[model samples]
Target: MGLTDTPPPHVPSWVVPASGALLITGAISWDMCYVLMSIRSHRTKSYGMPLLALALNLSWELIYAARVAEHPLERLGFLVWLLLDVPLVYTTLKNAKHEWRHSPLVAENIGAVLTAMVALGCAANYAVADWWLSAPGTGFGDKSGKWWAGREGFDCTELAFWTAGLAQLALGTGCLAMLLVRGHSGGTSYAIWFCRALGTLTGWIGSTSLLWWYWPEAHGFFVNPMGIFLMTTCLACDTAYPFTLAVVRRSERVLSDGRLVSGISVKQSAAPIVKKRL
Candidate 1:
């Protein structure tokens, strides 16, 4: 999303420009991460993104591209991400059963389950977007320049903040959850982890912090109790993920067909401790 309005005079000139640069950096890094996920998905015989994260992100992209997004470039970014996500979604649908074998209810009807997820995700995102855009001074129309014009909705920046934060939370936590559930790093790799961590750092934490510092009035929620919690939680999870991944990757076996055997590398793993007879 574009700034609540291009930085005003009181704010240091470098701040907005720097924020813009960080925003672009964040976007490019995330785009690269998405591509890497698709590539890793094909190689690993498992979906690249975690199920819940994928659903949340894809839903956000879908709605933002069609409804919430305003600026031409902002809309374009969401659109590109949405289009790029199609393959990732398909890959998940195709391979999800394998990942969910332990839960027959899930594995047996993954299609239905995913369908419900997208549907619910869409409804929830749409509700919030509509609420922001339609309340009194805001009322739905093209969101471009609405806030900057001193009309209403404050560029929908708050909406973008919360949604983006939610997506990051789902993804950050979902990655580790998948690792634990699958007991391996089937769709995960060091590069994927790096890009993801970097994306959040620059995307939400980095860019957000920059803008909030520059325009505290418009971006106060960046310091909201919920916002602080969301960002902190995501950072903590991402920080711990890679080390766990390293240990798990070593123990996980890979099948010849590119399938992952359960993670259990006894040979390369640490020797187990045995208790001496008491």
Candidate 2:
């Protein structure tokens, strides 16, 4: 009997022992809150885009995790995500223009290209990467054969991963640049600026991971997990900007309403006194 005949041991890592599970669960909960809040307020603008990104991220994460768990059909779900990501990447990039209108020509184009490349490469890599079943202890080993894990499966996969990282960096860098420009222009909100800054830091981590991928010795087992977590946090923070802004706007509206009500009450109280005195 071959080791591949049985399920692999469930060894976990400290970097994110249950991160895959948490990410899947947390994203759903957060997105549900976002949707409920948006619906209750009847405010659709700026909210839907972030929510959409979160949805896509969660969906792909689920597929990836399932594959790790050795689910046969999960590979098909990944392919589906790869296809769906094309339009999603476009949407994310398009929205950046509005968010960072003050961004320079280079920054703006970088953001656009980065979004597109990441989407394309991520989809392509999962579709073609041979490591899916070839790696030691993978459950798919039993069902998969050497034919499916040939050298061709390894071909340019690293390139695809690097391309995805570059795209993420470009978008994150652009967002940070836009925030700086906003600060200089005195027009950007603090929450949005903070989000971009967080993204920039995570983007750096992801970029570093790519650099590590090129070198065999420096590839710490934790590198991939750390990089993945950082990027996910970055994206989650970015998507949260809209919700933060919405909460601020809601607060301002409530304050305005209170002031108006007070003013009306004061005028009515004074009017009766004046009429009686006259």
The true-versus-predicted C-alpha distance at residue 98 of model 1, in Å, is: 1.5
Pick by lDDT: which candidate is best? 1
Candidate 1 lDDT over 98-118, as tens digits, reads 787879899888888888898
Stretches of model 2 off by over 4 angstroms after superposition:
1-23, 29-116, 135-178, 181-220, 223-278
Residue-by-residue lDDT tens digits, candidate 2, 144-258: 1112223222112232233334444444444344323322211224433453344344333433343233322322322566447646755665565445444444433222222
Q: Count clashing pairs, candidate 1.
A: 3
The reply for model 1, stretches above 4 Å from the true place, is 136-153, 265-278
